[model samples]
Every structure is written in structure tokens, then in C-alpha cells.
Target: MRETNLDNGVLILSEKIPGVRSAAIGIWIRQGAAHETNADTGASHLLEHMVFKGTRTRSALEIADSLETLGGSLDAYTSREHTSYQARVLDEHIPVALDVLSDLVLSPSLRDSDLSLEREVVLEEIAQVEDTPDDLVFEIHSERLWNGHPYGRSILGTKLSVEGMKGERLRELHSESYVGENLVIAAAGNVEHEEFVDCVASYMDTVVPGVRSEQVAEPSNALAGLELVDRKTAQTHIVFGAEAPPHSSEDRYALILISSVLGGGMSSRLFQKVREDLGLCYSVFTFQSFYRSAGMVGVYIATRPATATRASEAVRGELERIAEQGLSDVDLDRIKQQVKGQVMLSLESTGARLHRLASFALHDEPFQGLDDVLSGIDAVTCEDTLRVAAQYYDPGRHLELRLGPS
Candidate 1:
């Protein structure tokens, strides 16, 4: 991996992989839903859609065709922390990918009519979550857990906020946070570092060198221990757990290991016991959401309303068992290998590498190579896992958020 900066302070990171035919280039802007004021709640996401509508030099159709003609895909997504615009194509098409990506970020034409249509599309997106119990469960979990902190704000924003977003507000969002200081451009695959840097530097003129600031507030885990929402659905969607360490915390590694043991796969405690043994739910998994100064942990499950309480009890029982009994050395070693295997396997994809390249940089942390990551996991003793479990896995401490009929 190689890193450098354009004159305008836009950081560019790249890795050249031999024996590969594909490459992924992405532009990451540090601004996201968390950075917006109440009025501009969903503007970051809306702007992500608007940029694809057209640019100063290309219409939406042209932008759409720009990569499809090369048998590539250009896409973007807005998250709680940042927005990413990415392109994936064969090695020979890196230049085309770079050109289209640069145009989207540097020259978006946020037209009023485009915003009007995009608003409805975004509104539907917001509505779609209600219909998706799995998604709606977590959405409500965050809303209740964080209690109005930026972290709780939905990436899709509310109906009133989306409707209130003006073209000018979007323009302000782009012009302000999408500058060089808040941008990290990264690529991976069969591409040279110096050449990629040169191509990126050419955009220096329009890339603002000015600094952009963010006001980050870490929220207290104020949601009640249990809250059940009534919705007319077949099954009850549940999310349980509470606050955990951030990306920078050393406990971060232990948290990852603990979550995997809880619900990482078919062999995981939650899956084996909840589905295979009790025949409770079809989907059961653990999740960890990390941010700059805060993070969250939740285990999600869905089951028939009649068995929802049973499934939830099974989940809490598992947590309590692990926290009290502690993981054996054998269990600890197995989880480490499981995590290491997943990491090594994921390296085969250039898109995954692109995400790592930008993510660490955006979080203001040094990149952890495969060896470093594996070693970190290896160093996690059984005591470490037990410590984290004892700290965070108490049933009385975490939140139990249920969505669907009582």
C-alpha cells in the first residue's frame, strides 16, 4: 500500500495487486448523516442520489453509461459516518473509472427538478424500512437507544426533513464537507501507486484545500432496558444489546471476537441453539457498529409472535452463560481462527481492500495489515473474551427492542 496527498490536501491511497484483472476506486467524504443539522438531516444521502442525476459535463444517462459500457459498476452509499462513491472495473478501465468518479464529486449539478423527484424516491426508501421488520427493528433501536443523538438519526432522514431539503442546501452540503480535508480517495487492484496519484492530483484545482470541522457527540445508552413496539407483522423482529467500545479502543478486538462466538455463523452459539435446537428463528446474528468516539452491539433475531419471548430468552440465556462460565481456551482459539480465516478470505476482493484503505484513514487511524490484524486477534486471551462478556453481556444492562405484534 502507498499513500500521498494532492496539493489541495486530498489524500489518495492505493495498493497494486499482481495477478488480478479488476480494480476498485472510491471517493469517501467524511460528511454523513451524523454531521448534518436537524434541518439538513437527510441532505447527505439525498445529495448522494442527486450527484448521479447529472454533472456539469454529463447527464444522468451518460454517467450511468460511463461504466456500464466498460462492463463495470459505479455506485455510492451513505452511512452514519461517511459517504462513499465507488467504481469497480477491469484493470484496463481504471482511467475510465477515475474520470467518472472525479466528475461526480467535483461537478455535481444539483438541479431543483432533480431534487423534487429524488425526494419522493428517498421518501419511499424511508417508508420501505417500516415494511422491512428486520431493518425497522434496528432503526427503532437506534432511535430509542441513542435518544436523538446524531448517531440515532436515520440515514434516510424523516419525511419532513427530506421534503424541506432545498437544492441550495444540498449544494451547501457538497461545497462545504466534500472538500479535500474531508475527502479520502482510495483504490486497489492492478494499478500503480505513482500513476494513480498523478491521475488524482490532476483534480487539485477544484478540490478545496480548506479544512472542514465536525461536532461529534457521544451519547449515553439511555433507552429503557426493554421496549416493545406494536406492528401488524407475522413475526417479531428483535435487536438486543447496548453500548460498546469505539474503533480506536483496544477492547474493539475482544468485542469482535465475542460477537462472532455469539452469532458469527451456523456453528455460532445463537444459531446452533436458537435455530437448530429450539427451532425458534430463521435469522439470528450479532452486529457491532463502530464510530469515532462510540459504538454499539446488538444481536438480531426474528421468530413467530408466539415464540418471540422464547427466542429472546434464549438469546439472553446464551449471553448470561458465556459471561459467567467464560470461554474455554479451546473456544477462544477456535474463534480466533474463525476470524482470521474470514479476514484472509476477504482479501481476495479488491472492493474490500478499497474500503479498508479509506476507512482507517477516515477514522484517523493507521492501516492494520493482514498480519497485524491476525496477530491482534491471536493475542486475545480467553480472559480477554471473558472480560468483555462479563462487562457487556448482562441481560439487565442491554436493551431489548421488539417490533411486531405483542
Candidate 2:
């Protein structure tokens, strides 16, 4: 693993198992929907699509052709906290991967024609999410939890905000927010350290300084209560959320342990009780989404509307039980193993590895190694899990959201 600071942000380069023939490269930026005002709510996501439209020297088709010519693949995504543009290619095509990524990020043309088409595409994407209860529930969950914060806004962007997004808007956002100081390039797999650094460093050296917009203050914790949204469907979508620690918070590990006990896997309390024992729903999971400044823990489940209330009650019962009584040594050991296994298995892929490095670095932290991660998971005693449960998982703090038939 190699680490460096270019501009203000850190870059982590790891060349592992160099004999493996595939590689993944990603440019991760810290700007996202959370940084936007209401008018610019979807700028980050819109900017992601615009980058693919064309660059100053390369047409959209040429950009696609170059990568496809090398038998490689490319994709991008914008989330609440970050945006990533990435490509996966064979070892011999690392140059092509880095070149295309640089062109897209640094010199995107943001043509007028492309802007109009992508805006419509994003609106269609938003409509599709509106039609899917599972997807819609997350937006609703954030809305109720954050309660008028930018973090609650949909990353796909509101239809009105998206319609107003012209080519100039895209250029403005790209120029202001996609700064080198907030950017990091991460690569893994089948790479020689010196050659890989030279390939990426060459392009990054030419990157001009860009400006970042001011961040809004953290959301007011006044909405620290329950909320619900009612919808009509066959299966009710449920989400329970509460204030939790930010990324920099020391309690993050405990929260991870808490999430593990609740819905981390098939052996988890919710999975065993709700899905395996009672046959309530086909899907259930828990998720944590955090900013450097604030965070939330969310529990999600899908169940028939007829039994939605029962599922809600049972899930709540487990939360209260765990808070009050904690976990058995057997349960704690199993959860630790599951978390450790997930971390190890996911790092096995070049794409996943690059993503992990980029994300950790963006938060201004070193890549916590696999051993460090496993050790943290191992050190999570039953007391730690219950402590998080009592502090963050109090049932009264939950914001309930249900989308289905009444």
C-alpha cells in the first residue's frame, strides 16, 4: 500500500496480488447532494451523468469506444456523501482506464444537447424510484429523519430542480465542486506500484485548482422523534431511524456491532425471528449512513400490509430486548465472524478494494487495514453492542415509515 497527499486530500495506491490480470481505478470526490441547496439539489448526480456525455477532445462515443476497445467497463454513481467515477480493465489497459477517467473529470464538454437528454433521463430515473416502494422508502426515511436538511433530498434530484439544470449549471457545479483538494484516485490489483503511480500522477499534476461550496450547518436535532409516511401496496415497506454517530465519532464501531446484531445476516435476531421463524417478509436489513458531521442508523423490512403492524412490533421488541438484555456470547461471536467475513470477502475484488480505499481516504483517514478491521470487530464485546443499542436504538426515537395498503 502506498499513500500520498496531492493538493490537500490524500491518495492511496495499493498494488496487491500483481500476478492477477485485472485492475480497477476510481476517482472519488467528497461533494454530493448533502452539499447542495434546494435549487441545486441534484447537481452532483447531474454532473456525474454530464461527465459521460463528452470531454473537450473526446466525443461520448469515442470515450465509450476507447474503453470497450480495450475490453473494459466503466460506470459512475452519486450518493448522499460522495460521487465516484470508475473503470475496470485488464492489466495491459491501465493506461486507457486512467486516461478516460482523467478526460471525463477534467475536460468534460457538458454540451447543451447532452444536458437536455440527461436531465430527462434523470427525471425518468426519479420516476422509476417513485414506483418502487423499497427505493421510495429510503427517501422517505431520510426526509423524516433529517427533516428539512439537505441530506434528506433525493440524490436523483427533484424533477423541478433537474429540469432547471442546464449545461451552464453543470459546468458551474463541475468547476466549483469537483476540486482536486477533495479528490483521490485509488487503484488495486495486478499493478506495479511505481508504474501505477506514474500513470495517475501525470494526469493529476495538470489538474487546476477548483473551488468547493460552503457546507450547510448540521441538521437541527429538534426532529428527534417519530415520523411516518403512508402508502398503498401489497407489502408494507418499513424503516426505523434515529440520531447516531458521525464518521469521526468513536462510537461508529459500536454502532456497527449494533447493526450486526439486529439485521446483519441470516443468523441475526431480526432475520431469524422475522424471516426464518415467522415467515413475515422476504427481505430485511439494517443500514448506517453517516456524514463527517452527523449520522443515522436505519432498520428496514418489507412485510404484507395485513401483518405490517405485527412485524413492526416484533422488530421493535427485539430492539428493546437487545438494549435491555444484550446478546449471548454465541450470538456476539457469530456476528463478529459475519462482519469480519464480509470485510475480507469484499476486499478480494479489485473494484471493491479501490472503492474502500477511496471512501476511507475521502473522510480524511488512513485505510484501516483488514487486520485492524477484524480486530475492531473482535473487540466488540456484548457490553459494547448493548451500549450502542441503548444509546441509539431506543424505540421511542424511531421514525416509522410504511408504504403499502392500510
Candidate 3:
């Protein structure tokens, strides 16, 4: 991998993998929901949609056809800490991919007509979230977990917020957050470092350097207990979570191992104990959401409304067990291998590498070789896992959300 910084403050990173016929390119901006005010909630996500609507030189259809005709793909997504626009194409179409991506980032029209249509599209998206019980529960959990912070709000924003969004407001946001200093352009697979750098440099030369927005304030650690929202669904969706280490913590590797052993797969403790043995409702798992300054670890289970209490008890039992006794050496070794294998397998894809590069750049995390990552996972000791579990897995600190028939 190679990295270059343009005078305009745009950072470009590239990795070349031989024998691959395709390349993945991504433009990442270090701004998302965390950067917005209460009045301008969801502007980042709304801007993501508006960018693809049109550009100064290409209409929406033209933007779509430009890549589709080449058997390529273009996509974008918004997250709490950042937003990404990515493309995958045959090596020969690298230039075309770069051109389209650059245009979307640099010259989006953000027209009133497009805004009017996209607003409804975003509104429908907000409704879709409300309609999905499982999704709505997590959003509710987040609101209570982060409580009063921008991070607590739904990424889709509220209906009223979207309705109030105007073309001029979104354009103002675009100008402020989408500047040169906050941008990272990354590409991997079947590309030369210098050539990719030059390709990006040409299009980004006009971007004026600007300061990045302030970082999000750290969230309070006060626990909000069991929040129940009534829905007429047959099954109940529950989430239990607490504060965990951020993306940059030294204990991150240990936390990953703990999360895997607790609920990562079919063989995980949650799946084996809750689903396989007790015959709870089918889906049960664990997840971790890591941001620059804060993170969350949680368990999710869906079961018949009658069994909600039992399922919750079973999850709590496992959490207490791990916090008290920790994992056995054999279990620790096994989960480390699982994590190492997953990381190695994912790096085989150019898209994954593209994202990894951009993310590492944004967080100022040093790029570790695959072997180094595997080594980090392997080096996590039973004692290390136990320490993390004791610190982060206290049931008293957890916030619970349940959505079901009341």
C-alpha cells in the first residue's frame, strides 16, 4: 500500500494486487450524523442521496448509465462517524470510475427538483425503519443509550426533520463538510500507486482546503434500564447493551474475542444456549459498534412474546458467567482462530481492502499487515479477555430495550 497527500489536502491511498481483474475505489468523508445540529439532522444521509441525483456535467440517468454500461457498480452509505461512496469495475474502467466518483463529490447539482423527489424517498426510508420492529428496537436502544447526544438520533432522522430540509440547507452542509482536508480517496486491486494518485489528483485539484468539523462529545455512561415500547408484533425484539472501548483502544482485540465467543456464530454461547438448547425464537446474536471516541457492545434476541422474560434471563446468565469466570483457555484459542480466519478471508476482496484503507486513514490508525492483525488476535491472553469482560460486561451498566405486543 502507498499513500500520497495532495497540496489541496486530499489524501490518496492505493494498493496493487496482482492477478486480479477488477479494482475497487472509494471516496470517504470524515463527517456524518455526529457533525450535524439538531435542526439539520440527517443532512449527511440526505446529501448522500442528493449527490447521485445529478451533477454539473451528468444527469442522474447519465451517472447511472455511465457505469452500468461498463458492467460496473456504484453505491454509497452513511454511518454515524463517516460516509462513503464506492465503485467496483474492471481494471480497464478505472479512469471512468474515478471520473464519476470525483464528479459526484465535487460538483453535485443538489437541484430543487431532485431535492423534492429525494425528500419523499428519504421520508419513506424513515417510515420503513419505524415499520420494522427489529430495526426500530435498536434505534430506540441507541437513543436511550447515548441520550441527548447527536449520536443517539436515528441516521434516517425524523419525518419532520426531513420535511424541513431545503436545497439551500443541504448545499450549505455539503460545502462545509465535503472539503479537501476531510476527504480520503482509496483504491485497491490491479492498479499502480502513482497512476491512481495522478488520476485522483487531477479531479481533486480544485478542492479548497477547509477545517474539519469538531469531534462529537463523549457520551455519558449512566445506564438507562429496560425501555419497553409497545408494538402489536407476535414476537418481541430485545437489545441489551453497555458502553465498550472505542476503535482506537488497546483492548479492542480482546473485546473482539469476547464478542465472538459470546455471540458471533452458531457455535457461540448465545446461539448454543438460547436457540439450540432452549428453543428460543430463531435469531440470536451479539454485535459491537465502535466509533472514534465511544463504542457499544450488545446482545440481540427475538422470541415469542411469552418467552421474552426467559430469553432475557438466559442472555443475562451468560453475561454474568463470562464476567465472573471468563473464558477457558481452549475457548479463547478457538475464538482467536475464528477471528483471524474472518479477517484474512475478508481481505481477499478489493472492496474490503478499499474500505480498510480509507477507514484506517480516517482514524489515523497505522496500517498493520494481515500477519500483524492475526498476531494481535493470537496474542490476546485468557487474562486479557477476562479483564475486558469484567470491565465492560457488567449487567448494571447495560441498557435494555424491548419491542413487542404489550
Per-model lDDT: 0.88, 0.81, 0.89
Candidate 3 residue-pair clash tally: 0
In model 3, state the lDDT of residue 405.
85
Clashing residue pairs in candidate 3 (N, C-alpha, C atoms within 3 angstroms): none
Candidate 1: residue 259 lDDT (0-100): 89
TM-score head-to-head 2 vs 3, winner: 3
lDDT of 3 by residue, 1-406 (tens): 8999999789999999898999999999888888888888898999999999999999999999988999999999999988889999999999999999999998999999999999999999989998898898999898888878777877878898999999999998889889998899999999999999889989998898898767777886546578888899989999999988778888889888999999999999999999999998699999998888788998999999999999999999999999987779999989988998899899999999888878778777888778888888888898998888988886667888899988
Residue 380 displacement in candidate 3 (angstroms):
0.8
TM value for model 2: 0.94
Each model's number of backbone clashes? 0, 1, 0
Q: What is the C-alpha RMSD of each candidate to the true structure, in Å?
A: 1.2, 1.9, 1.0
Give the worst 10-residue stretch by lDDT in candidate 3.
Answer: 215-224
RMSD of 1: 1.2
Tell me how far candidate 3 lies from the true structure as C-alpha RMSD in angstroms: 1.0
- Candidates in descending lDDT order: 3, 1, 2
